[model samples]
Target: MRATIKDIAKRVGVSSSLVSLYLNNRPLAARIAESTKRKIDAAVKELNYAPSATARALRKGKSKTLGLVVADLCSDYSSFFAQTLLDECSRYGYQLLIGITHYDPEEEKRVLANLIARQTDGIFYALRLFPADFLKSLNLQNYPILQLSSAAPEFQSMELAREEALKQCAGKLYEYGCRKVVVAHESWANILEKELEAYGIKIVGGRYATTSDDFPYLNDTPPDAVASDSSIYARLLRARCRELGIPMPYLCYSYSLPSDFIDDPRVIAVTVSDYKTRLSGIVSRMIRMLENPKEPVAHLKEPVRLMSLDELREYRCAQLKDPYYEPFRIRIKYEGN
Candidate 1:
């Protein structure tokens, strides 16, 4: 059995109340001599007794724990988001429980059910797609849930504005002379990728994008273009580029590329915002709303913030570019256009 203050007091032949005061670093009355405090400390060290959080939380009637759920753990962005949520929750003296559902709706439902069963104080779920009846059921339960990166059927969520962000990225790529770029992405993600295509992007791997037997990458034949569904498939396409010796430069739409892969000069990776930074922002806003707990959820619908690739690149270029000009004297031109 784990030792408690009672056990420590029994071992030290002192009152449990005195032991508690000594253990909590509170000043005991002058009647309790310093020598007696040393005995209690020695007993505690010998027994390796630790305070119980379960007891404390039960007494306080607050669990002080937060649950975080993510759709796919394999994605860099999802993994980073999980870590960030934990860090953000820590600032509020909250413990975090994490759940991974691997992008399956049934699995996601199961994971959420498990977290709820564990009695987490709140939940933050990142989903690929929201399920039907998700919001209605939650509204019935009156649960505190935050959604990220997935659309909930009737449940409102904050997610990266993928379409808007990618459109800006694609436009920047077009400006940078990447006309024949291919955006290899999941089939369901094609809708999001199409936002860029609508802005005159001729991506090679989008829907209606073709494959050819005449291509050097295909040793034998070609097949009709089908949407990709996994990062492995995306890597296969990159490998095909290697096999064909196609020197086309590309930027990944998602934070699926590993750090090692991003180091490749041919690839320009877009860094998603730090999960902890974004979550901290969200939690701060939520805390502010809690000050006026009576406010409707509609009043709390401040847009979730996301960083754009164009903004990231521009920041990076500004940092890399020299601000001071060399001492070169140029003659002034008098002609006005």
Candidate 2:
């Protein structure tokens, strides 16, 4: 059986209250007598006693766990974000719980409520669709909410400057001699279609945000290149083209990590909106809010750049020592490395 604080108290001939005061309560540690603290410590070591995390969290009203509610994890870009966020959470000794909604409103609501019930310290919301006073609507007003969007009255947010990103997509595709593009997401496709029309590139077709197996557009003559907000869509398109014995077009998608797809010759480029910086930046704000409940609402915006295959290859070869991307040694060309 696992030893508990009561066992330690019994071993030391002291009250479990005093043992808990020294073990879980930090501010009150000073209140414990030096002799009592030493007795508790020795008893803990001798009995191998451990405090229950759930009990302590309930007492303190903090689980030290943050929730990331995202649309889908199948996408490479979203997966990277989750991985980076997990790393960030671990740095501060906090746990991360991800809830995948798959763009379903009912599923989104259920997952959110479940996260809150688990006593998540805060929630980092990445969905574009917002319901005003959503927390209040669910009777979860006291919970803190953060968003990947612009300034909002109720919650803190970190926005992405997507106008320039969309423009870069069209301009790069146009430069690549692409005249028509099929996008992955619907709402985003609507905005991107308008932007592409500005560059004389037409958006031929689009699909739902989460998942769509039927991409008849690729089965046909195929557009110049398939542009996607998520790399998963590009991957799906590639699979469909292969199954139908059709050639895949020059593909463009969003993914900052270049090393993951450098070998794909058909890929035209990937957009990098400084994903690493945005995640770490927002994580900092999340930490502040978790530590200080009264922290004011904060808002921010970031940029995006479309990096062509050549630029990505250059970035890979140079491989500078970066805090975000760890630098490593590569072999000389003579060894067939």
Candidate 3:
């Protein structure tokens, strides 16, 4: 059996109440001698006594645990986010419970419910296909729930404030003489189109492809460039171009590019935001909210920028030195040397 505070007191031959006061670092009465305190400390170590998190939480009315639920862990962004979040949680003396649901909405709901059932103090989510209306049905309106990437308006969010970045991206493309482009990920089509049009550029087409083979040869306007929200899709665009004997430069969001892509110049520009930094910012806010106990609020935005090919290399190269990059495959090569 695990040693309890009672065992420590018994071993020290002292009252449990006296031991409790010392263990909690509560002010002891003057009659409680310094020698008794030292004895209790030694006894605690000798008994291997550990505090009960459940009991402490019951007394404090909040668990020192947080939940992180993501759609997929295979991606670079997810791996980076999970590791950085765990590091942050450890610093705050909190435990983290992670759930990976592979973008399944039903599984997302189940994992979320389990987190709540387990009395997690707060939740950080990055669900691609989460149903906001169905979440409202859970009646978690006041809960400390924060979503990453996009603003749901229903949940307190740390969104990738995209307007500035998109503007810079469009300007960069315009500078490269790209007046027309096709954007992959149709959900972002209208937004990218609006931004590009601001720079007098036009969207020739849009495709939401999951596989390289899903890219179709577009006959409209013969785009000067192709932009994609996913690294995988951007790769497919490059493949399609090469297969057709056409040279093309593409743009991709920096969300999931493995750090190894720092050397690849085929990518023209990146809509860049530091996911680890944004996660840290929201986590600090969430910790404050949980400690103080308040109603959840509306959306919050985190600014992003556009990194040209040269700038992307410099930025990613700097990230290679950060501890967060240890999970990247590049780390294997880095450590091998």
Candidate models: Cα lDDT each = 0.54, 0.74, 0.72
**Model 3's TM-score against the true structure:** 0.77
Once fitted onto the true fold, the runs of candidate 3 whose alpha carbons sit more than 4 angstroms away are 1-49, 128-133, 198-200, 205-213, 218-222, 243-245, 255-266, 323-337
Model 1 per-residue lDDT at 325: 10
Worst 10 residues of 2 by lDDT: 327-336
In model 3, what are the clashing residue pairs, if there are any?
Answer: none
Give per-residue CA lDDT, model 2, range 139-213, as digits (tens): 655457887843566677777666676777777788889997877776457567777888888777553334657
In candidate 2, list every pair of residues with a backbone clash: none
Which of candidates 1 and 2 reaches a greater TM-score? Answer: 2
**Whole-model alpha-carbon lDDT for candidate 3:** 0.72
Q: For residues 1-337, what per-residue lDDT tens digits would candidate 1 score against the true structure?
A: 8999999999999899998877766655545788997898799899999988867775576577877887566654455556656767788877888887876778887788788777776677655534546645544234566555554433335655444545555556665655455444443345535665666655454343233222332333322222232334445556665777754345443432122122234344353433334567666654543344454443122232223445444443332342211111111112110
Q: Give me the runs in candidate 2 sitting further than 4 Å from their true place.
A: 11-14, 18-42, 52-61, 71-80, 100-105, 128-134, 140-142, 149-153, 175-177, 206-212, 259-269, 291-296, 318-337
Tens digits of lDDT, candidate 3, 75-192: 5666767877888888898889998887777888899989988888888877652566777777787778877755666667776677777767777778888876777665456577
* Rank ordering of all candidates by TM-score, starting from the highest: 3, 2, 1
Badly placed stretches (over 4 Å) of model 1 are: 4-49, 71-76, 129-141, 153-156, 169-236, 247-276, 285-294, 298-337
lDDT of 2 at 206: 53
